[model samples]
Target chain A: MRSSAADRTRPTPLDGLVVLAVLAAAAAIFYFFRPVSGNFLTARIVLDNELVAELPLSDLTEPVTLEVPGVRYPITVEGENGRVRVLHSDCPSQDCVHTGWVSRSGGQIVCLPNRLVITVTGGAAEADAVTG
Target chain B: MTHSVRRLTRCAVLTALALAISVCEGLVPLSVLIPLPGLRLGLANLVTVYALCRLSGRDALGILVSRCLLGAVVGGNLTALAFSLSGGLLALGTMWLLLRVPGLSLFGVCIAGAAAHNTGQILAAMGVLASPAIAIYLAPLLAASVLTGAVTGAASILLVRRVPFDEGKP
Candidate 1:
C-alpha cells in the first residue's frame, strides 16, 4: 500500500528512452572506433613509455618470439602472420597474457604490470585522448 | 532516536553493508557468469541507490565514500582505490542528478550511472597506466555495463520499495 502511492520510485516511461539513448551511444562508439584488420603488419613493442622493439610481421619467415624482462618476471611476446600476442607472463593480473591477440591496426596488447605496450600498425598514429 | 542521530547511524550501516558486498564481489570470478572483461554485477551500488531514493544525497555520498575506502582496505588491494573511487563518485553523481528528473526512477538513473562508472574507471586507468590505448576497452566496457546496470537497477528498485524504513521522510 505504501509503494502504491510512491510511483516516482518505480520505472518510468522515460526509462525506455534513456536506455535506448545509452545503448545507441554504445553502438555508435563501438562501430566507429572499431579497429581495422589486415595489411598493417608492424608490431611495435614499448616498455615504460619507451619504444622497445619493432617486429615486421609481413617479413617474418617464421614465428618470432621475444623474451622480455618485465618488472618482476620475464614476458614472452609472439608475432607471426600479421598477428601478435603476449604468449606468456607471470604478472599477478595476467591481464596482458589474457589479451589474446592483435591482428588489426590500432589494436594493442598492454601489460601494465610490466609497463609494456604492443601496438600493430602500417603507420604510427599518435594516440588520441578522449575526455569523459 | 533524534533525526540527525538516526540518519548518521543509517549511513554507517549502509556503508558497512555496501563495503561487504563490494569485497565479496572482488573475490568472485564473475567472468564465469558473464564471460566479459570489466563487467560486474555492481551489487554494492544498490545500497547507494536505495540510499539516494530514500535518504538525502548527503547520506548517500557518505555511504558511497566510506564503503569504497573500507572495501579497498578490507580487500587488501589499495590499487583498486583509484578505480573504485573514481567509479563510485561518478556513479553517485549521475544517480543523484537523475533522481531529480520528473518521471525517472531507479532504473534509468542506474543505467546512466553505470555507464558513467565505467567511463570514470577507464579515464582513471588511462592516467594510471599512462596509455591512451586503454581507450579501446571503453566501448566494450560501456556495452557490458548496460546489462549490469539493468540488473542492479532492478535490485535497487526492490530495495527502495521494500525497505519501508523512511516512509515518513520527504
Candidate 2:
C-alpha cells in the first residue's frame, strides 16, 4: 500500500508551531537591532561613491542646491525642522525624490543612476540597507 | 493521453501558467500597494508550490527555470534576470528540502522558501552593489518574507486542495 502525495504533504500541528517559532525569532532579532534615536544630526552626501559633503541638519537655515561634477543636474538639499530631504533632482528614476525625507539615522536617499547617496549619520538609525 | 505525452503537456501548461503569472505580476505596481521596493505578493509562487506538491521535482524545476527566464525577458529588465534567477532557484531548492520532512506541511515549506528567496536576492544585491552593508536588510526582509510567504503558502494549499490534478505515480 502506497500513500498519496496529498497524505504525504499533510501538515501536522508541529509544522505550524515550527514556522511560528521561526517568525517570532525573526521579529525578536529585528527588535533587538532596531535603530535607536540619538543626537547625530548630519546628512552625508556621496557622489560617484565618494564622500562629497556633510551637511549639518541643525544649522540649515534655508534650502541649498548641490552641484556634482560631471552630472548635468544639481540636487537640491533642504533642511527644515530637524529633517533633511532631496527636494529636486534630474535623475530618471526620481528615486531620490521619492525618498522624501531623512530625519532619523540610517535613513538614506539613493540615486543609483547618478551614483549619489545621502545618508543620515549620528542618530539611532543603524540599518545599513533598505529592502522591499 | 499516453503517460509520456500527458506528462509533457502538463509540464508545458504549468510553465505557461507560471510565466503568465510572473508577467502579470510585473505589470502590477506591487510597490504602490505594499509601499516597499523589491517586495511583491509573489503570486507566481503559487504555481511552483502546486507543482512541487503534485508533480515530480524534476518537472517542477523545469517549470521554475523556464518561468524565470521568460518572465525576465518579457518584463524587459535584463539586469534583474540575475536576481530573479538566483532567488527563484533558492526558493525552489529550499522548498524541496523542507518537503522531505515528515511532519512539515506545505505552508512551512513555502514560508521557508520565501525566506530563502529574500536571502538569495540580498546576497545577489551585495555582489552587484559591491557593498556588504546590504546585510542590514536581513531582518526586515525576513519579516516581510514571513508575511508574503504565509500568504502564498496559504493560497497554494487552497489551490492544491481545490484544483483536481491527476497524481500519477512519480
Where does candidate 2 chain A have its weakest 10-residue lDDT segment? A123-132
Each prediction's TM-score versus the true structure: 0.72, 0.66
Chain B TM-score (each prediction, in order) = 0.92, 0.91
Model 2 achieves a DockQ score of 0.21
TM-score of chain A of each: 0.63, 0.59
Which residue pairs clash within candidate 1?
Answer: none
- Tens digit of per-residue lDDT, candidate 1, span B23-142: 788789677886666677788888888788777788889998898788778878887899999998999998888877777766788888898888888888888876565677778778
Worst 10 residues of 1 chain B by lDDT: B161-170
| Tens digits of per-residue lDDT for model 2, A1-132 | 111323434556755775776677568756665554555467778888777777766555666555555654666766654567888888788878877767766778888878888888766443232111
Interface RMSD of each: 4.7, 4.6
Give the number of the best model, judged by TM-score.
1
**Residue-level error in angstroms, candidate 1, position B113:** 1.6
